[model samples]
Target chain A: MQQSESQSTGAVGARSEQEPSNGEIVRFDQVVKRYGSNVVLNELDFSVAPGERVTLIGPSGSGKTTILRLLMTLESIDGGVIWVNGEPLSHMRRGGKLVKANETHLRRARKSIGMVFQQFNLFPNMSVRKNVTEGPVHSLGVAKDEANQRAEDLLDLVGLSDKIDAHPTQLSGGQQQRVAIARALAMRPQILLLDEVTSALDPELVAGVLDVLRNIAQTTDITMLCVTHEMSFARDVSHRVLMFDEGQVAEEGPPERIFGDPQEERTKSFLKAVLENG
Target chain B: MNWDTEFAISIIPQLLQGLVVTIQATVIGYVVALILGLAVAILRRVDYIGPVVFVVFEFIRTTPVLVQLLFVFALAPPTVAPLTIGISVLGVHYAAYTAEVYRSGIEGVAKGQWEACRALSLPPLRVWGAVVMPQAIRKVIPPLGNYLISMFKDTPYLFAITVPEMMFMAKAIGTEAFRSMEAYTLAGLFFLAVSVPSAVIIRRLERRYAAV
Candidate 1:
């Protein structure tokens, strides 16, 4: 089943110059993470293919966001290896040993993965244009002139071109988050991680950010893995949805099957609760 | 004795020179404190090494400033540069207090800030340089400025080592001329001149920080 899933997602981007076909963009092999006796991610096996949109949905503390955090190399896996673009992300093989990847190696690998957080973490000291241009100009070493052009294009894409010179505090929460999305997109990452990107916004503001994301998902070829409480948006935007519970994937499938015909009793209870609350 | 005229005349050059030394010590000492304090603060935040750095600074902080200055000055080799020794002793001593100032500032930053940085996958250095330190540094400005004023007042202690700082000059001139009143009064005025305005500025800065 995993092989088939990889193969399906692999169709979008070729793996390497000589492979003639795309390999997995991200693969987690029985990964586990623990924090001082509390297991955050248990022996979890998940994979995302190039250009595929996968949304993870579950209640708080179900470890949905942890999955995305681990992939972005923000958290280390205690038990298993993670492969990004078919290379180990959490650890490296050094001197016939699988040592943890240091700062430099992890940084190089992270260039291909972009994450948008629940809180829009714009640099408060910087303007919108500087915030958008920061990662590409500093991390990727793109030239300033080129980075500015790309930032301008992204601001237009996110409907914030007029707010380029504005500080983050001046804009509404939804606008700041849209700028964050544009900042992530500026990196041109093969996989984008969205961790409850709209959870912190006002109800009216949610739609604007969601609209920007939907536009990106439909128009662009970038792959995305999102953890969200927006069940309806997840159902509409994602090709596959995974429901996580207590550090494990309890259920996963195409949105129709997962949302409409869930096999797990836990998933059904969660969906019922969310719908009732909403 | 033409006390008023002679006092006013003596101050024109000597007091200016002493003011120059006092200001120089304040600037250099504050800079050294800033750099050393930040280094010690960050070093103490590290997991394994933090305790070691904290203990060293703690010792410096708990000990008397006078004793610390004397010990540091004594530890210097006779052939060593006087300015280096003077600035180093003052800087290292006051840095202990500055480190505590910075630690509080760093802790004042919200946990959400750290979480946001982690979610962004920022390297540790970038986290400090861009996200963490900027906010932390902003918070401690008034406290840090207050430390600068305190360090300025402490410049008198350099007199013990014959470093020829402000107070040392006052003491030397008074003893040599057998008249303590005018020289000491002038020295007191110079200190008040620098410290009084600085204290006011610090209060204003405190208000600014409180607003933030």
Candidate 2:
């Protein structure tokens, strides 16, 4: 079951890297982020090309998740500019001078991106149907009937069709996470940020969510920036795996090379910890 | 002073009339209190000190209800009216308490929930309306409901304002008819008749919220 999915994902990864590299979907130019005196992302330079699947793997507090959050505009970048789909996302050029993107600009840009949190952050008040359809109907200006149809289809894709009427409380952890994935997909975002999506699920439920994500990575055109601890899933689904340590990319390569023959001591140590613990 | 006979006949009608007035005050005052309390509670969530609202809430909660009732009722003219002032005082007074209930209920919501709402980039007003308020309101149902019943019981205090609510009517009739025992007893019964059922509803709401 896993091998065939991996094969298809490998093909998709190959295609994305080799395709016409016209417009970069996301670019981070010398981004630096800090909290109080603690620096989380230091002089980070990364770019996610259109249709690429980039997996960020690192130990806790390595700022892998922070990168994703910054892109989603949940965290402000203390220094640097981010360009999304050729438009500056972090700052706007006002009168030929750069200024921070205000709330209105950020909201408009963020609407094009969807994030799946590790905790699955489903709106507890909404049933699965409402959760999936809210973004599309409200933010994307999709008609209600069209959004409902899309929601049903996405629910089926996540293998949670029966849960559409159920509240977040009624679903299992994996089921709720699946609903969350569907919720993000509803907006038809240009990029999807998965922050350790399966890390919070139980062992038995992990496979189901991973299955849905594998399908997305293979079949969809959405650019994905994923931070995950699942090394095997990362290897199977990622076009490029970036190993982060101390808030910078310690190593980056195609998954096969990164997993098989890591170049950096920090990368080797992170892999050893992951393997020894797994 | 035909104690038993006068008490039995006059007290029943007077108590009944007083009971009606008491219930009206309780219902109206509680409704105002609940709404105002929720508003104050939500306002407190704002990061800014919110323009002396905290002071006003503290003032109401700290002051004695009897004094407030008298001041509101006696000072206000018929144009302003004792009934309106009386209910406002009761509502705003207990609103301070209800505000606490709301704040606690809001705090009870997991931090994860707020982060999730932000992740979705829900507009601020919708974030409150769609995500935060529902959970906060649900968590607070029990305590707010308790306040409602307590406010109902406190309705008798409005009598000082000459509002002619249940307690005042019973006291008046009891003094004039010289049947204090009967009138007071009937008044107690009137309170029980309303408050007991309201208490039952509050308990049921508490249980339901707890189950969730």
Candidate 3:
């Protein structure tokens, strides 16, 4: 463990001096995040290559959602750094040293990342069209006419063209989540984080939201980092699955390897429990 | 000793003039309170000065509007109109209360909404203006309407500072006519007429938005 920590630090230093050597799009080097006395993520080291789809699956309190939250900058890290697209995300280089990032730095780094929440978090006051167009028109300065057109097209992609003028409060949970997906995609983010995007939906509604996500996976090259319990969906869409245990990755490989031939006792039991429950 | 219809009718024109001033004061004062209160609520979110703003607003809220009006009246130059002083003082005094209303409204917005705004990388101003304030203001309408009614009633307190509002006119008519009952009764009727309907409208709005 000590050797791995040193190696991760050395790798971060080398990468900071130059471009990301392996062309990894997102890298977490010795990142530590804690909530009061509880350490949510401890020296977590991982990286996602561009256009790769990675899913995180584990029991509650294993820091699966925390990882996505960190990447989205919803919560600050207690230690180490997160690099997105070869630039420091949680910190900025100031006078040749890494320092905690300010709001300006975080805002700039966050523009390339978009997140969809479990609760669908669509602006209740806005119509579906405005919900999808808001980030593009207001944040990115996209023209209103172009943004509206793009919103209509994206709603069509999510099978919600008819509901474009409907308010989010007027839609079903499944429909709202689809609008949220379209809203995130409207920003044209290079990285998408899904934090239990369907966990709040009813069982019947879950499949519809999952199908929208599956369609996006098939059609877009956007890198996805998802935290979810939908094992079958994870297996189908994920290029790699990381099995988390105690805030660290216990096992990581192709979904088949992790599910069919798990090496760790933790991984074997977790998969057995999940598969049995399903 | 007797109810006099002619004396009451004679005072109507003078009282009407006072009613106009009263309405003008209430409208202008309420606008100032709404805008200034929102500014206070937003400013109180700043880390370093938030506590200071909170304490200052608390000081204003705890004191009576009568004392505040008298204090401002005394401090102002004589050139400033008494009505102007009344409007400014009443506006600021009620702003202290409205600020709390806005603070609760802002806090009532869900945490997920803020996270979504940040995730979209919306600028701080845009986040508050487009997302937070719209939702917050909706939830606050009923409470703010209640404050407006309270503020209208409070306009009579301006009489202490010699502003010619409704109560001020009633008092002047009583002094001139030596009959206090009719003028005072009419002034009370005007307040009831405005306040009751406004309260009903506010109740209807609350019921409607609650369903949303």
Best by lDDT: 3
Using DockQ as the yardstick, the better of models 2 and 3 is 3
**Candidate 1 vs. true structure, TM-score:** 0.86
Off by over 4 Å in 2: A1-22, B1-6, B47-51
- Kindly list the per-residue Cα lDDT of model 1 for residues A1-278, writing each as its tens digit: 99985663343123221221245688877678998899988888888878889999887988888888887777777876777876778866554445568978887888888889888778776789988887787677789999999999999999999999999989999999999999888888889999899989999999999999999999988989999888889988899998899988899999999989999999999999999988
Judged by TM-score relative to the true structure, which candidate is superior, 2 or 3? 3
By lDDT, the candidates rank as: 3, 2, 1
DockQ, every prediction: 0.34, 0.40, 0.75
Models sorted by TM-score, best on top? 3, 2, 1
TM-score on B-chain, cand. 1: 0.92
Find the candidate with the highest DockQ and give its number. 3
Off by over 4 Å in 3: A1-19
Question: Which docking category, incorrect, acceptable, medium or high, applies to candidate 3?
Answer: medium
* Tens digit of per-residue lDDT, candidate 3, span A1-278: 99996675665566567545567999988888899999989999999999999999988999999999999999999977898988899988876666679999998899999999999899998989999999998889999999999999999998999999999988999999999999999999999999999889889999988988999999999999999889889989999999998999999999999877989999989888988987
- How much DockQ does model 3 earn? 0.75
Interface RMSD of each: 2.8, 1.9, 0.6
Lowest lDDT block of 10, candidate 3 chain B: B88-97
